[model samples]
Target chain A: AEGEESMAAPADKRPISTIVIIIAMQAEALPLVSKFRLSELPDSVFPKGVPWVRYYGIYKDMNINIIWPGKDTVLGVDSVGTISASLAKGACIGDVFLASDVAFHDRRIPIPVFDLYGVGLRQAFSAPNLSKELNLKVGKLSTGDSLDMCPQDEASLTANDATLKDMEGAAVAYVADLLNVPTIFVKAVTDIVDGEKPTAEEFLQNLAAVTAALDQAVTQVVDFIAGKCLSDL
Target chain B: AEGEESMAAPADKRPISTIVIIIAMQAEALPLVSKFRLSELPDSVFPKGVPWVRYYGIYKDMNINIIWPGKDTVLGVDSVGTISASLAKGACIGDVFLASDVAFHDRRIPIPVFDLYGVGLRQAFSAPNLSKELNLKVGKLSTGDSLDMCPQDEASLTANDATLKDMEGAAVAYVADLLNVPTIFVKAVTDIVDGEKPTAEEFLQNLAAVTAALDQAVTQVVDFIAGKCLSDL
Candidate 1:
């Protein structure tokens, strides 16, 4: 096994050099920034016309940047290209992506997975192989903006056939794919979208707690990436 | 900080001996069981009248058990006491609890936290202190059994004033609190539950994916406990 390990080809070898974490919330980004000791880059540092806030710093010798897509995927598309081009700067070295966001699930459980599609693109990108390493569940994630538009009824879910549904996962996945960033999506569940209750109230009441959980999930991914990169070295 | 670290009382320190994870789905359970290499205990090994199947094994030298509480809080009440007592058998040693399930939020983003109230318990329980270490959000959790019975309009959210809502979190918390066990409730958002789509159809479609996310969150908790315990050693 040691001989086989050493015999592996270098061309087939991809050591993670930089990891770009694209997330949706400032809350989610704050904890990771602090945990990994990330510092916000100057606004002028970002590419011109970039619509979202971008933060950059290093964690354990790996370059890490967190991008906030502000609220939903529609907001993300405006800056996806800018985000992609910026990441392309590190293309000379292998770069991987870990996109984090929230989703609405009908079940009273949160399933984390790489989303499968965005609006225009079919067969969107995902890192299923990596999901296992991170102990995450991989499934088809549906992306849209409004919960009212999201399938809240069993009939809707059956019609959609998407196991995972979110407002932004697919858009991030789609944009990352176009940029050729090997991306893995990390999402934590916050609410059960089964039309049984009013969302505004639930969200307002549980926002702090759910955001906290999302923060934790993001931290785990960051740590996993750090550990994975170090071992690859 | 060095002096503070040194002054930390070793006598008051208790290493985690067992970790109990209560969840609602088989999809969530399968992943954790496999990742941690947990094995099922014989049905007969469980205390008589146990309503749910329990898996017990070791993950990083910690006795980790995964309990399936079926779909909602109503189902959980059946086995919560039994599960609590089982863990109490190892009560002389310190034990920690990680409760994983799904929730509802109004906004698209998923917030992670423990909800506060539910169907039966007038007062609910949650572990907010553990939220930071676990990277989870702590807040009021609302638990109930029927999705239809849940509030489904903006009026409801305004009326409830809760940020997080769920079907089972409070029940589990109430039971854990009653058992006098120190527990941390970890939940991911699944749906907005704010009257978008009818839930029956939606739940059937997205059940698998939501549960998987819950499973991943649970896995993180287990790993956290293991790492925390190992560092203590």
Candidate 2:
């Protein structure tokens, strides 16, 4: 209930009609594309030669678009949006977690007032009822572009009290916030950042199973979101 | 006339009313802030703890907002936006240049189709008349976070045919594109990327004079942009 006040419906109270799912990997996007029966739009939908891919379809009353921002790993968030989902580190494999908040671990602006800006913290949209109904783990998510954790990043992560770590979540949150759109993060854990096993090996090994779990959890989230305004979540 | 087709006014044809100038350094922002006779708002305009600074005032009919995005080197682009100006490498000191196009030199997605996405290329809003009127140099801009260029970055910049190098222009262009806002870039050269002197020395030596030159050029740009729609630029 800490963030419940901020969850009050906006003045417009428009019903959610369009849903965009931003996926970072082809492997993750493939399952959702098939499950949602999304048709791939032509490459021409984007400017010439950009590798971004868009898949769209109507699921019930919701218009759904799944975007894959190619292999370069930057997310282009152009959705009338909500829900930035991705695979996270620092949790058990296949555990589904909902972000309570998001911040950056790699960006450090050490100036007195600017230190806060360096972290770029943002709250995830509150969804208490839905979170309780699904029994999802809820905690802070930290992001950086690097897969390997440096000591400074570790310090930043500790400072942020981050329970989930990913390369893309905060970037998506920043964009979503800029658009005045509320966002909830649904992340599936694929590898433990501090575990003895190699990150790439564990990640690749668990990616498939985690992707399936994530897909199921997200589908339920979408179902819960249907026929509701943002505050309803 | 090459990019003229994309310059047609939108159906709504709303007259431009708000102008946001995103400056990375406080030194760069000070002169413009003084010239525009802007007042700094309380830090509370942004979320608590973020160090981003905003100075605003009416310049003629335009509501001008100049933002300094803290010391962390990350740009939080929250504006009903336009011009993204910054300092550049690869041109003579105090030379003001206008970006014809922008791209990232560091993001390389090597997959066959994804390679194009790796470049993240975008056109600067067409402004031939303004460029001609100001006698500004017009060329491609390549961006990356690092000031020190690697061999791969060099190759990419060459491939991009970059005439200027900076840390933030392409990113601003990317965000502006997502918002369907056209962006034109005006850059002042401080250090040559491949020049003989150490970059830091050259940059420090030239920054004050260059900032002055940049401030003048941008003031003229803002003046030219007044009383016009985006297409008019």
Candidate 3:
């Protein structure tokens, strides 16, 4: 609650004791970042002064900021700490949205792809008292800057039992878990991941579906969050 | 080093020491339990039949058995700590390999192409003492798995800045960084991250070059190990 004390009297331009850490694997990635900030939502989350409105457009009601660690988990972890610490963002409210391909699409790596999202989900869902199934299976949305050819990765996914493979997804999960956030992974299948023609065309074909999936998943969590928030109210 | 205490002990099938917490990412991956056997390294480093191996594959040393956390830094951290703390493995030597995607390729996620291997290298290399030009990149090495497009990954390696990406590479690096082990990510890029064909095809094309690069990189470190081993003798 002291977090509120410091933010309530903010001298400069910062939020009121609440901040969210949205980790983008690659900072230049616009597509992935746009998903979290659903434009059609009640109010646009896009900041007014930011010039990259077209590029950065924000997600609604989410106090999120982005950082690109360029694909290093250790550094990514450090970056998470640094970014939040720099913004003086509190660990109490720093939620992360991971951006990467392997995270949302299953079977990108040779090892059991199942464990890829499993670890993240397990860590996120296993946090204290939380519903394991319904909240996780449907509400947790996976985000990725790109997609994969599912058919190609499915075999590996089957082999490894992975649901998604986004570059930044796990890193975000790992960090958020460490910081203790009700981390939600909004994963959308961008590619078949079968290793066939995993191209922009493939991504475009799946974009809207994945985006819709992310949108629905985020909203689904509203039920759970509302319940939790109601307790506070 | 407490490792020296168990160094002379004979390998036994019986369990000894205490506390065995296996942080297996894949429940189905339980087969790894039977497949791996500790004590390939040295007795002092590990206890009885903990049945483990580093990262992947089997142990040739028979001195210690370690089930290396395959990928994902959190699990890697969890497993290493579990093993290190457990009486079974004891606090001996922590051998971990941060293996990730060696092949750099873009997966078509719903909206764009996400590069799977971009963050591993960055995570692995973005620390204090690791260097690619000097081939002295970060901490230790334990069992190795390279990206099939290993050669391509090496070719595409961009260290102009700090951290880069690889699949399992940095996961291991994180553990090593924590445990203070000199790590080597012997990754062979099976394919380039930006490729458009079967990773196998790219693997075929780049394997030779990748192997050479890996061999050279590994040899430099391996030679260092050999030199240390020889000096001790």
Identify the candidate with maximal DockQ.
2
For each candidate, the alpha-carbon lDDT, in order, equals 0.45, 0.72, 0.32
In model 1 chain A, the worst 10-residue window by lDDT is: A81-90
For model 3, the superposed segments whose C-alpha errors exceed 4 Å read A1-123, A126-156, A194-199, A227-233, B1-233
Fraction of native A-B contacts kept, per candidate: 0.06, 0.03, 0.18
Task: DockQ winner between 2 and 3, please give it.
Answer: 2
By lDDT: ranked, best first: 2, 1, 3
Q: How many angstroms is residue A179 displaced in model 2 relative to the true structure, after the best TM-score fit?
A: 1.7
Name the top lDDT candidate: 2
Candidate 2, residues A1-233: lDDT per residue as tens digits?
A: 01223356653365677888888777788899999899998744675445678999999789988888654335432211112232334457888989999998765533334456657899998999889988898989998654545566677888888888887888788767755567788888877878887665676678789889999998999888888777677
Worst 10 residues of 1 chain B by lDDT: B81-90
TM-score of every candidate's chain A: 0.64, 0.85, 0.40
Each candidate's TM vs. the true structure? Answer: 0.37, 0.58, 0.33
Candidate 3 at residue A188, lDDT? Answer: 40
| Residue lDDT tens for model 1, B75-107 | 222221111110101111112233333222322
Of 1 and 2, the candidate ranking higher by lDDT = 2
